[model samples]
Target: MGERGRDRSRGRPLPLGWDEEAVPADLGASTSRPVPGPGGDGEAASAPASHGWSRLSRRSRRLIALGAVLVLVGGLLIALPRLLGAATGPEQVTREFLQAVVDGDLETVRAHTQDARGVSTAALTAEVLTGAEDRLDSFEIRHVAVEAGTATVTAALRTGTESREGTFTLTSSEVGAFSPTVWELAPVALPELQIDLTPGVQEIEIEGVTLPVEDLLMNREEHAPRIAVQLLPGTYDISVPQVTPWTEVPQRALEVPAAFEKSEISVHDLQLVLADDARAEVQRQADAMLEDCAASTSSIPEGCPFAAWGTQEDTPGTWTLTSSPRIESLPIAAFLWTLQGAGTAEFTPAGDAEPIEVPFTVSGTAAISGQGALQVSVPAEDSEHYGYCTDAENGYITGVVVLEEPGQDFSSECA
Candidate 1:
């Protein structure tokens, strides 16, 4: 009956054990004890459970520690150089100033200057430092000696084919509590520009601003006028003003260097001459006018300086120019020009008689109209006359008449 009761108790549902105690398997030999219930007395109370760092994975803990170390290292790497630079001495400042000048850093150069009151960034150009930098292929500070708040730094400089040593002086000043001493450089003079003009040049102009010749000339000199002007560093467009009968000088733009004590520029003269294209155009118009004279059948065509005459009852003979027209003078002004040429005209009579050769001198003035066309004016004062055969009572008639001559007695010749 007892065995049956035990089996029946096992088969039945167990009661909830709120007061049970759980021990680790490694501590199985220890004494077994029952835990107090939720409403237990203070003597049997349970301690709160702990979730310490040992619960985290090993790799996760190691990664978090490495990230903190990397952050600290990166911050030091970024800030260490700036802290060291703030502690630079006067000699180091001078060396940095020279290096900045060579690199053409105008702002850094100006900042190191003793007095930058009137100096501007525009005035400190790369062109200004070109001469000095060109002379130095490479440079390094050799030695720096400081005494009584002043520092003298020696630099080893190299050129293309030469090596030299130079010294720079710096005056020390207090920057701030956290910063080291700063230095100021002495004032350096810019180069002078010498303008050498040609003998005929009387004046000079730069960028539309005219500079007086006397002001540019050197003082107490007996030679011809030459200018020596002190200029700040920059590029300038220079030219000579136009004098009468001479063309203006072409523009000459030059960059002035800061390191050079003296630089020279020579100016030349430009003269005006008649263009070949203009002369060729005038000659073409003169030849065209002479060709038109041969085609005219009037007693005297307006532009025809040489023409043949015939009787009224007979058909007019055709005239042909035997020689090419020549031009004597080219038109200088837009108004008028006189061209003179000599040509022969062949006149064919209406009958089967031989053609006669007439020698004539042609002179005419070419006027240019407002629309730029050539207007030929052949005056009557200087023209040739020729006699041609005309119909009369005689078996053959020859009449003499002056070409381009007004009110001539042609009736007597044909009678």
Candidate 2:
């Protein structure tokens, strides 16, 4: 150390292994500079600057902008219609459903409905509904109300010349997590036509359109056949096709109310009127059968009501129909007209000079069962109204036999 406290290490031995060469050459001068990197330059090497947008070519940038625009447009296209539909709300949905029915758009109608309870939906077809002459003419929406998640739409439907007001119920549901709500009509029990018909009836004409009964048959309730037809608000004329020589039902008009107004139409019994000629035809058939039976040579004609015997064993009685059977009334039961009448047959024994008149009552059915043709059977001997005339030798015909001959005693004819 120097006396004045100045370091004299330059001329004297450095203390504690200090090396003057390792020290900076110009340590007292002030200087600032970056440390050298592995490349040995005074400043660190840097890679080229990379900006994503700047890296793309000009045309590529234009294409990217167009793609973004298309995505935005596609999103809007998908959302716009849903937004518009939502704006119209349930009232519009109700109107659309009714319009679909009138348009005969079955797919749309099914989509809008929740549950359609009808035994037979055959008449609900687009073709059938469109072809119906009594189909709905038009509809007008009167009012709309919203409550909770449900909606009520009041409307009037015009069918033919008649108009009726009714209410429709609807409920809303979300289509998807991102989609707008969808409205659907609530459960609608379609109107039913309960028609009372003869069991064998095959077809019926409604509004001048013929439909098979088997296709329209929905159910049988209270022993009456019920046909379920999805009818619009309209008046329909229904008639059974002519069952020839037996029964026919004239066209009857039925007014079907709205779906929610009245769900059922109990069309009164299809009162079958006996055809004017049917009665005469049945009568003629009965008389012909009786006459044919009387023509037999045997004492008791095969199916005839009378039997006569001669005193001798070798002789048989000759029989002839004195009075043809007359049909008093033809009452139908189970598709058959039961005949009630009486007839007379004269029988002459071979030895007797005079003929004995035998009176017989007739009772049986005129059946058309399945084949559309008529068949009459009026056998007095086998039927409930059996009457036979015989002498004491023939066994008694049981169950209150009556003698129509004023002078003849009952014991002689019955016993």
Candidate 3:
């Protein structure tokens, strides 16, 4: 039995359980195997592997191909929208910027600009937005075009009854991960205020501050003076001194817009005729002067109207002003004025003598005194007649006195 066992160990094979075929399959062998193809060589010798693949059902093959195709298409779908968004980011930012401006969202607008230094958001909202919104009826974004981190946006703006198109330009830059692309706006310059005045406006006052006309007249364009001034956004009360005696202009109120680059204000229409009360007051003072002159016992009383005449001796005749004085020139002030006028005076000789008529021109200053009394004064000139005359010769009154009444001429008898 030992010889037979030794022979079996040496020569005879064991059962299938202990044979090499019984070893477990290697996990890597299937993957490491060469793929089969039509090329002739060792690679073609591996063509038998294709037979196993061919054994699969047609439906299974189609499912595998479709899954592969879906993977490729899904990857592109995930990446495409992000790329498109980056490309159009500037345009989106521009649209948002304009929307903020129109809505008066000043904070948001400031956030979108890099050059917002010294810009007041409150001023923008209060002055620019308020004024624009009051006039704007509608607003719409027309188009947005983006290129190379810069964008231009066009919009249609309807203000009052007018419709206009406008444009805004914006730039973009990378901010951070959360906001990869941030946009900004260019700096805007402050605005100017241009004032156009009437021919005789000597000076202007704004907010109790006087502005000289000569200074504003510098850099004049043609004969028309340029009154342009640089000012911050605000409301202003402007006043111009009187230019003519017959008219008084009122103060002008103006509101400067925050967004205005340049604006014009014209003061041509502000002139108005002198008030009736002022005109009547002046006429009354002149009439009182004439009456005082007629009642004065001296040839020329101190406050008399004809005191401007250089007569010395007391004339033995009753004097009367024959015509209403015509005011030729007047210098206006806040509460005083200098007035000049012409009239005729008649002197009747004491002993039934013919009356003599004299023409005269007089100038006097009138004012409201402390006691609410209107005081008038005629300033005397050297070698000229004024006040009570002590002595006079070369200052003779020479003009003819032609007195025309409603129905008769009193100077006709003298002629």
TM-score winner: 2
Tell me the alpha-carbon RMSD of every candidate. Answer: 27.3, 20.3, 16.9
Against the true structure, what is each candidate's TM-score? 0.30, 0.51, 0.39
Q: How well is each residue in 128-238 modelled by candidate 3, as lDDT tens digits?
A: 345332333456778878799778777775544456565667787765433446666544333454565543345676665656655555335433444655443445666
| lDDT, candidate 3, at 109 | 56
Q: Which residue pairs collide in model 1, if any?
A: none
List ranges where model 1 is wrong by over 4 Å: 1-87, 110-124, 127-135, 175-179, 190-415
lDDT of 3 at 342: 82
How many backbone clashes does every candidate have? 0, 0, 0
The residue-by-residue lDDT of candidate 1 on 261-318, one tens digit each, is 2334444322112234434655666667667777765434555666554434334666
Best by lDDT: 2
Which stretch of 10 consecutive residues in model 1 shows the poorest summed lDDT?
A: 267-276
Candidate 2 lDDT, tens digit per residue, 1-415?
3575574444332322222123333556422224577777667544234434444555877788899999999899778767876766878877877888777787776564434354555555554465456566688999988888899999988766667787888888876655777887775555767776654455677766677777777765424555666665556677877645466666787876655443667765664556767777877877777777777766666565556634344247678888877786444333455677877888777674588777877776665433345556666334232233322443321212322444444344333
Where does candidate 2 stray beyond 4 Å?
1-83, 110-118, 208-210, 220-225, 243-250, 259-262, 271-273, 283-335, 339-364, 369-373, 377-415
